[model samples]
Target: MEEEVENILQKGGELFHPGLSVDCVIFGFHDNQLKVLLLKMKHADKWALPGGFVYKEEEVEHAAVRVLQSRTGLGNIFLRQFHTFGSPSRSDRKLNRELLVSLDLEAHENHWFLQRFITVGYYALVNFSSAVPRPDATSEACAWWDLQDMPPLAMDHNHILQQALETLRKQLNDQPVGYNLLPEKFTMPELQRLYETILGKQLDRRNFQRKMLGYGILDRLEERKRGVAHKAPYLYSFNKEKYAAALQDGLQQGW
Candidate 1:
């Protein structure tokens, strides 16, 4: 672990751009709740968003994709750049040095990782069951945390998360957003639950269904979901072509 940390720190100076990083708020939907992927630091009792430095040769967006893939083991995810955070105090050099010392690794005063970084904030929507989370070199555990029950996060991550969620909520008002966060086939109630979870409020069932159906982006299947105690609800799936078009063109209505 120490060697791996050393290698990453050394590589940061050689292969990554200085003073620039990418932090991703990877959102997932499962069990009718909204979740965000987070990492628990190895030697600290703190959680953080999945993030990393930008490689010198990589585009800022590609670097975000690489970071997300490394942490979540999923590719082709729905990713978006929402904002840039450049607060001078966002990075804490003293605490970073302490963490390295805890790992019994040398923390050089001039190390690139100790410098203040201006990070690009991105958010990704992925199917909860599809992702296999993996910790990075600095993190000991990688897992999902409910948005409302998140623990103390490191650095400016809590602020970053708030901004990401705000961006997601605002985007929900303008565009369609459930294709990647849900299974290929789902029920209307399931889809509505996902929206309600992100929006932090319940939508009127009839109105939500009418609005969704009116968008012309869903294909209702004739088959009903089986084995339910109550009357089975019909299954629905996104019409990929229309869904993609809706994503490109705004939904033109808000809840």
Candidate 2:
């Protein structure tokens, strides 16, 4: 453990660019609730999003992907850069001071860790069931928390989360990105529930079905969803081919 800490300190400058970092707001859906991944730091009560410094040679988006993979043990997921936070004082000093003391960082190491960071924010949609939550080297634990019940996050993460959710809401209307949060096969109600979770409102069932099906992005399968309380709804999968074509030609006759 001492060697590990030393190794991290030695490579700190080379492995991470001085002023830039990446913070990922990974959203998942399970048990009818939209969840966000949060990390508990060693000896810290404040929670944080899975975040890391960008390597000197890596692109920002790639760095975000690396951070997400390191924290969650999942990859090849849909990630999109939503915003960049470059406030002169984005890092919280009090939190960093306590964290540095807890980690017993050397003077130079503490200075490096407390430097001003302009973070690129990325939001990802992952299938919750497939995600194996893992803490990064600096964190003690990691878990999913419902968006409404999140713990007080360190830094400006609460603001970042709000921004990511707003971006996701806009994307849901313009893109078929919400399919990333779902299984390969799901019922119309399941899809509706996912949208409701994001939009924070109940969509009219018949109108939602008509509008979603009108996009020609869903492929209705003959298979019916099992383990339901009542009549099993038919399963449907998003058609990649159709979605790709629609992206080129525009959906809903360019409405």
Quote the positional error of residue 209 for candidate 2 in Å: 0.7
The residue ranges of model 2 lying beyond 4 angstroms of the native Cα positions read 1-6, 108-110, 244-255
Best by TM-score: 1
- Report backbone clashes per prediction: 0, 0
| Candidate 2 structure lDDT | 0.84
Candidate 1 Cα outliers beyond 4 Å, as residue runs: 103-106
lDDT of 1 by residue, 114-141 (tens): 8888999999998899899999988889
The lDDT leader among the candidates is: 1
User: What's the true lDDT of residue 241 in model 1?
Assistant: 95
Clashing pairs in model 2, backbone N/Cα/C closer than 3 A: none
lDDT of 2 by residue, 1-255 (tens): 545755665567678888788899999999889999999987577889998877778888888888888777788887989999999878776676665566676545446666777889999999899888998766778999998799999879999999999998987766775566889998999999999998999999999999999888999998999888889999999898987676455464445
